[model samples]
Target chain A: MGVNTEPDVLPEARVIAVAGLGLIGGSLARRLAECGRRVIAWNHRPAPYEQARAAGIECVDDVTDLARAVPDVLVLCTPLKAMPDVLAKLAPVLDSRTVLTDVGSVKGQVRDEVKAAGLNDLYVGAHPMAGNEFSGYAASDPSLYDDALWAVTFDECTSYDRLLVVIDMICEGVGDRIIAIDDDTHDQAAALISHMPHVVSTALANELAETPSRNIAQALAAGCWRDMTRVALTDPDRTRAMVEEDAANVAQLLHHMSDRLESMATLLESGDDEALAQVRDFFAVARPYREYKARERGGAAHESVTVRIGGDEASWRDQLLASAKRGEHIMHMTDRTHAIAEIRTALV
Target chain B: MGVNTEPDVLPEARVIAVAGLGLIGGSLARRLAECGRRVIAWNHRPAPYEQARAAGIECVDDVTDLARAVPDVLVLCTPLKAMPDVLAKLAPVLDSRTVLTDVGSVKGQVRDEVKAAGLNDLYVGAHPMAGNEFSGYAASDPSLYDDALWAVTFDECTSYDRLLVVIDMICEGVGDRIIAIDDDTHDQAAALISHMPHVVSTALANELAETPSRNIAQALAAGCWRDMTRVALTDPDRTRAMVEEDAANVAQLLHHMSDRLESMATLLESGDDEALAQVRDFFAVARPYREYKARERGGAAHESVTVRIGGDEASWRDQLLASAKRGEHIMHMTDRTHAIAEIRTALV
Candidate 1:
């Protein structure tokens, strides 16, 4: 309950502007509106306008109209490829009070685009860990954002006050959780978890495709192979774009995974007592993860805790990043100085 | 319809002995009885005996009791670790009229064990692509084998008549499909499609577990990461045993996968036009597989065909292996000379 000089800190995001109402934006806009926050949306196409309107989302034609509305937070829900043009359009019209954000998979790329557009002062990068194989406005559902964990990213130039505003929009307005982290950490983690795995899956599919007895191999393929290669079935163009956007991180992870596989191969080939023991070690290396998943299957419980943010800029940011690294998801802020988080990602 | 020279071919396995009443064996026992075949079963434990009787399956107290019954085909369904012991007990009492078979995952190793027990002459190697996560008779269901594809493996010493007996048990008694190939080919394909992928999944899980910001990466994980790592969450002890049994093939495939990943990593780091082209080619290399899956998803039809099996021993075995390599699943024996197979594993 220590709210003082930062009166604008999470002053309850009342009006929200959503530009580019695809599946993610459409779902976000609908949920925010359903949660009682006034929503103004604009899409590249008018196809979703009728249904969005029926769901109580007001639609506009021009992208700049969303900026002109001067909502508390204006989220650019366009694809990463379309971000530059959208940011270009909103550069002059976006009100200073409207904290800019996005639902892009990569944060650093989007932040750089925002900075290039001279809107870095009003920017807060975000990525919602929510989506299905299906996309477009028609496939969007308000519940898509239900209980979702979002990465709310920042950098040296990010305003603490603006971040609090976006935090309020996520935790309170959108009824979801957030982890406030730096842009680089968010991108690296995203690549580690998603992008690198996509490339691995693709490589597996390639292996099967290239095998001489492919038909025989495919015939004998079961749950393990099927599950590991499922993501390789996704649209390659889209996957390629996502990987290329975060090349360095994905490449680094690919190298690490290559080394692990090669090392395992060597041990399997050795056939000696020591090699066998090392093979045992290779599988045992993921013991922590296996235990965590087993506990998750057993419906492990989460503990809730509160985080205090009352210090200089660097220390405050460091505290938040540390909380995020510990896997504490900010559910909501009790006041500008305190945030309630749930310890759901605990490995042990 | 050439039946004169090989009268034992397609003679049919009316009475069956199942050694081990765990999930795979128990389900097979029940399914055979339900399909009107006399089913005799034995287990190291007697927990499933009473229940087995109720299901019309004759449960024997001792493993030797199974051989004493002189069933038409005796299936050693126990774990690989228990194979030698079970085989030794059956060796002396087993009837020469009985064709020996087992539903082991790896065929070459099992055949070696059977040879060591002096029962290789009667042995027929079989592996059903079935079973869920559950084990034990209580978790077994008759429908566990519904429409399953089984690999019916052989070697230089594999008698054609004994192979036919096992084929009769699988195709008619158990109502499944079969693909007869050499033991080495089966092991190679199994390693390619299943064992290697399991290790790769485990490697990915290890990466996540060892990450400094593991909690953060886990939080960001979605369907791609979850699916790719699903098998890694399997019991490590069991996974290690399976990998060790098929070490050479798995090791070779792991080496190939590592090379693919490392190549991609180099291209990703290069970031030049030529490097990007190579990166695109890396993803494009899987085009054959992606297209195959796309066709599979579209409910591609399987055309019926009859494969002839008559010639000198080596040529006939080669013909069958070629048929399996073409993904033809033998549905039933049309006669001593031909088999009805469905062209199901069509990759293109």
Candidate 2:
């Protein structure tokens, strides 16, 4: 076989290694430490080390020190672009006992980097659905992860035991919900929700920037415009990088979005009886989404269910993926055989 | 002449008439009453009459009675589609002493309706930039008008005296800011800021509804997605009506937006160094807006200025429009010849 998947046993995670103490990394390390996990953290810059140690997190000078410590779980909280270099550094010192994972926004490329670094056997993937517009260690807060949901991703060569350890870190340690799926699914879903929308928001702000009567238009702007363009105000370099990293998926979604807007323009420009009827239909197609939001706003509690994973080792992944597709979030693992989940975001 | 421009010495508005007790109308009537004006109101259904009267507003049986009272200003608070019928009802009874204005979202259409109803001479269009997701008198809030800016639109035959009376209602009676401009400019600015952005937001929601992995995608959604899609969850019928009212402007903007998104997709799909550079440029185009928003977040005081209106009656309108184009909100009128404005939304 081209890859190894021999390992099948990992102990419950009590110690976690966090690499790179940025906003996401710093918050996660602080949270894990607060959960009573021995969080060992390293930052490229030692600026946050003192504060991190004061939070009861152990500080390390080099990332290799994290690998040498051989914690139950090692989370690479470094930015996506920093993945390869950090992965390369950890490849030699990282013990097989440590299950590797990351909190990168994009999963497919991060997985490719892990494979390239010859650390695929130990790597699982994670992305916590938490953040504000703010960034850096100074903006990091343990409460950022409050009631957060995460996507735990895998691939063909992914170790089940490693996946279990990552799930332990997320569900038991971080006190969050998760959906286990493959890397490609994670990337595409992320593009649809986050990456592609960032491009659209930027396009909007760019259009306003080019408008001759921008100031007058902006004066008339209300909550709608503010909410729509809020993401565009984030660091452009960072947004560009995120969009570029998920290039193909974002491009595909953009094309779909472009077509949607073009067709709408045509319908509006026509301004005939039939076109007007079509425009109404254009708004109608989103009725399901609108209704879903209505229910969400109604504060209806999501119904909880138990999912029993069955079939072969391969089919267990499929079963969980299918459950996620049905809008279920695995809240906790009861055992190797079953997981408890909540139906959180289903649309009719 | 097609329209009349007579009566140059209209009195300050101490008496106000409000038609329709829906969200916008009810909120406005309550606010005017609280400001200690003699507020008379009419609604098609008297459902809100009890509550409105309790709030110190005078309830009327018919809209014509509002006109018969000869209030200093008669503010039509009905929805745009109801404008024609309401205007037709008030046309014969509306006293010449009453300056006419409507709080419609679209100005061009309302002006046309007023002209058709033979009430153009009495009309001075006004639209308050205030509302919430909820509707009806139940959700009517006096604080809705708190620090609100209004667009007071004019036309070729718009009476200068009538404009001053309407300005009195908005400034002194309602305690708000105003920007006096022509109908088409007001319509276009509203389209640029509100109507067109509503279409874009709905399109985003529609796109998400159609995505195969929608639930999975939505699971990954956080603040950016939530804020961007919030407006789409509002009543689609209302959104559709607003978009249709400004079809031409909204269509043109959608085309520009579509092109922007498509070009970014092409640059991303190319995935070369030059293409990447272009992608960076795409994000960079919005830097001015970013900096503007940053400065706004810093909460620096907006520099205030006094604009002197001169060069004949026609040129007075031009002077105020020019001030508005420079991102000024006319806070209070110092005199007929001078207005005090704040530099609130300048882009560069």
Whose lDDT is greatest here?
A: 1
What docking class should model 2 receive? high
What tens-digit string does per-residue lDDT give for candidate 1 at A243-263? 999999999999999999999
Candidate 1 runs further than 4 Å off: A1-9, B1-9
Each candidate's chain B TM-score?
Answer: 0.96, 0.94
Clashing pairs in 2: none
Error of 1 at A117 (Å): 1.3
Question: How would you encode candidate 1's per-residue C-alpha lDDT over B212-234 as one tens digit per residue?
Answer: 88999999999898999999988
* Per-model chain A TM: 0.96, 0.93
For B294-326, candidate 2 gives per-residue lDDT tens digits of 899999798999988762676878887888889
TM-score of each: 0.97, 0.93
After TM-score superposition, the amount by which residue B169's alpha carbon in candidate 2 deviates from its true location, in angstroms, is: 1.4
Q: Tell me the deviation in Å of residue B77 in model 1.
A: 0.5
